[model samples]
Target: MASTPRSVWHNPVHFLAFGLGSGAAPRAPGTFGTVAAVVIYLLLPVSNPLLYSAILLLSFAVGVWLCGKTARDIGVHDHGGIVWDEFVGYWLTMLMAPPGWFWIVVGFLLFRFFDIIKPWPIRWLDRHVHGGLGIMIDDVLAGLFALVCLQLLAAVI
Candidate 1:
């Protein structure tokens, strides 16, 4: 693993891309980042799908630039500590989710599972893609996978 420099905290781009320092955790930084996302999602008033989707899209756009800049500064591609992708991915997963802590918890678990497991095309993309898009794409796909599952579960229940 590449060591994140102190300078990372100083750079605004790096700081945000690193999930406001949650990504700096020595263990499971991605998971920590996702937890941070969950907290952020809970804090926001997202009763409207259009607003939520717009925010998600904007985050993703900014994330691509920020993640790319941070990875360049850290001299690594998709550094484990660069977890802006996870933040955006989790938010995307929660889109249109039914109202409840139970669903949120389920989304978190499912997103993490798919992200960590990287099934099929997810793994392929992670291996083949490069740069900021690479870092964000796999997680986006994982989020989509989790979203599908959550929607199915919601329907079943």
Candidate 2:
């Protein structure tokens, strides 16, 4: 595995792209980043889907730049440690999610599952895409997939 960049600590863009430093974990950085995202989810006012959607849109937009710049600076395309995508992905998974720690945990697991498994077009896009947008698109899809599943589960149970 590549070394975690020191710039992650000192550079603001790298820091943010690294999921506020959670991505710097020695192993399972994406998981750590998603965990960090869980904290962000807790602080957000997710009762309003409009507000949550706005936040997801802004985060996705900003994450492209943040992830792109950090990858370029570090000379790695979609470095495992650049995990702002995970943050946005997890938040997307929780869109309109039921209010409770149970939902939060479920969202976390679902997002992580799809992210790691990279099902269908997600795997294809992850391989075909490049740059900052490349870094984000797969997780974005994973989040979307997880979102659909979670919403369905919510409706059923």
Best by lDDT: 2
Give the alpha carbon lDDT tens digit for every residue of 24-134 in model 1. Answer: 988899999999999999976579999889999999999888888888878889999998999989998999999999999999999999999999999999999888888
Give the whole-model CA lDDT for all candidates, comma-separated: 0.92, 0.95
Note the clash tally of each candidate.
0, 0
Q: Deviation in angstroms for 69 in model 2?
A: 0.6
Regions of candidate 1 where Cα sits further than 4 Å from its true position: none
* TM-scores for all predictions: 0.97, 0.99
- lDDT of candidate 2 vs native? 0.95
- Model 1: lDDT equals 0.92
lDDT of 2 by residue, 1-157 (tens): 6889999999999999999999999999999999999999999989888988999999999999999999999999999999999999999999999999999999999999999999999999999999999999999999999999999999999
